[model samples]
Target: MLTDVQLRRLTPREKPYKLSDTGGLFIFVQSSGSRLWRMKYRFGGKEKLLSFGTYPEVTLAAAREARDQARVELRAGRDPSLTRRQRQAEAKRVDKQLQHVGEEWMKAQSARWTPRHAEDVRTSLERLAWPDLGHIDLDEITAPMVLETIKKIEARRAKETARRVRQRLSAIFLFGMAHGLGRHDPASVIKGALAPLIKGRQPALIDLEELKHLFHQVELIPAGGIEEPLIVSSFD
Candidate 1:
């Protein structure tokens, strides 16, 4: 049981010395006066050491909380260190086909969006989502992963950017699915996870700009073509 006062008073010796705490947690005081927190544990017949972090910066209570979390993971039959490493390594592998799917989706969709807006959407995904998720398969990228990426923009207090980026993500997923490149829209699962944008700002589901674009798209359809069947069926 090391108190804060005792922790502050701990002096560096000729070599590293560990001040023990409960549950195999301890602080290693190095000869250079640096204090680091570590936990000793065993799993699958192998002894392991987990590094908590530096003392004071991580804080005693925070280190204990992290240790308890690791214990919970251990109880659940999971290796916390391995899980962390997997998450950290997720971005290193690139899936070129899925990135190509994104580019194809953009090219097909660019006709529906203004040139500037298309660039904006592409840039948002490239800046925030692509680094973490562009490498993952469309169906393999989970909702939690999309939520995590969107939350980064939210964290920066860019409410509008976050909102638009989330929309773009969902549209991309839907586009991929329509083209048989994806099975689901993970972004749609995290719709309300972000902080809500200003209420009643646009104030219409079919706003003027969207309405114009809708009409423009409709006009682009060839007369007496496949669209005539849909419009005729609409009356029936």
Candidate 2:
């Protein structure tokens, strides 16, 4: 069922062309004479094409397997082509935001922060935040995603660090909004979404006798330093 043009797409370079058994996938020669696997399909009443990657790198078996999975998705009322396109679009948007914010943040801190502190903030953002959320659009960042990221930091018991990162992220989102890069400020709306800080409970004193004893203990310490009695009574 494969056409000659399609066969020629797989012209000999140093390898033989392999076609899928179902005739929907094939290895074809590219303009550069390199064999490439391509899949043809129809979804949502529209024809679509997908590249299975170049030869050798994608091997015949691997390409067929990938094509099979795509076909399975297509049969299940899904449009794999549209899904792929959306993912690509999202990646492009995220990359743009990351680059823009990174440059702006660098410029804003150069005059105010010391070299070491600047580097620390830059390095932390680049390493921790960039890898996961770098490519996502700042406006598209949801409260759930921000909460999830905060939870990751909280799990390590770095509450202060988590708070600082949240502040930085909020600033980045604000910057993006100011520059007209995005329409919504998702970070600004996460006040109630984050976990609340809990203050430690102080011990309660039941009677005046305990209070007098505490004061006596406190008086026995040095003038400049009240030591253990003060430390104990402070909790009261």
Candidate 3:
């Protein structure tokens, strides 16, 4: 067993060396005077190493417990080193969501879209959707969050615009999923969730009398002024 008194007496040298403890754990003393704890083990007939932690900060007892835990994980056919790396990679992948994937999807679609339309799509997201959803993790976004955005647009009497925004968000989510940025499209669950659009009433003359009355009013414009000709010709 490695004693605390012996550990405290360990001094740096011209080169790095390790003082081994039982069960593949060691205290690696570096020339720079940093004593870090390390563990060496084998999994699947391959040798792998794990770091328990540094000395002083991580006591002897703590290092031993960590080594025991690693052994348990190994007994269950799990490589602690590989598992740690996989978890780290997954965390990194999950962080690249929403804005990151969205920008990438837009770049890919730029070739297929007109410049004006591409800009319109970008503007819609930046001005409307991004404020709420841009920084969110792709998988973490929910239908309620997206619907709230649409409802905000609807509250402004922009029902058609809200529908278009929802469609864009859905497309972005799908794009993210295809590229592995998200697991599922949250917006897919809600369709027709926004308020229905009310079409505007068109103006029309009710009868011949109304039509003739409009024509009569037009004919009353004073003749020969530049504005009169322009105003009269506008009705044509």
Query: Best candidate per TM-score, number?
Result: 3
lDDT of 2 by residue, 1-236 (tens): 44445544555555554565453776665445777788878876777778878877876568778888888888888887776789899766754575467658667757976565466567667755777677776766788887787677656555545555667777777767777776665655665666665457534554333344445556557876844335432211
TM-score of 1: 0.44
Arrange candidates by lDDT, descending.
Answer: 3, 1, 2
Predicted candidate 3 versus true structure: per-residue lDDT over 1-236, tens digit per residue: 78999999999999999998999999999999999999999998988889977889999999999899889989999999877889899777655667777787789889977565567667777878889988888888999999898788767656555666787788889897787778777776677576775545524434332244346446555666436433311110
Q: Higher lDDT: candidate 1 or 3?
A: 3
Rank list by TM-score: 3, 1, 2
Q: Give the TM-score of candidate 3.
A: 0.47
- Candidate 1 — which pairs collide? none
Candidate 3 lDDT score at position 58: 97
lDDT of 1 by residue, 1-236 (tens): 87788888988999899998888789999999999999898888889888988988988899899889889889999887887678667643332235667787788877767675566557667877789888778888889988998887777756556666677778778878887778899899998788886544344433333343335446556867754633311100
lDDT of 1 at 74: 90
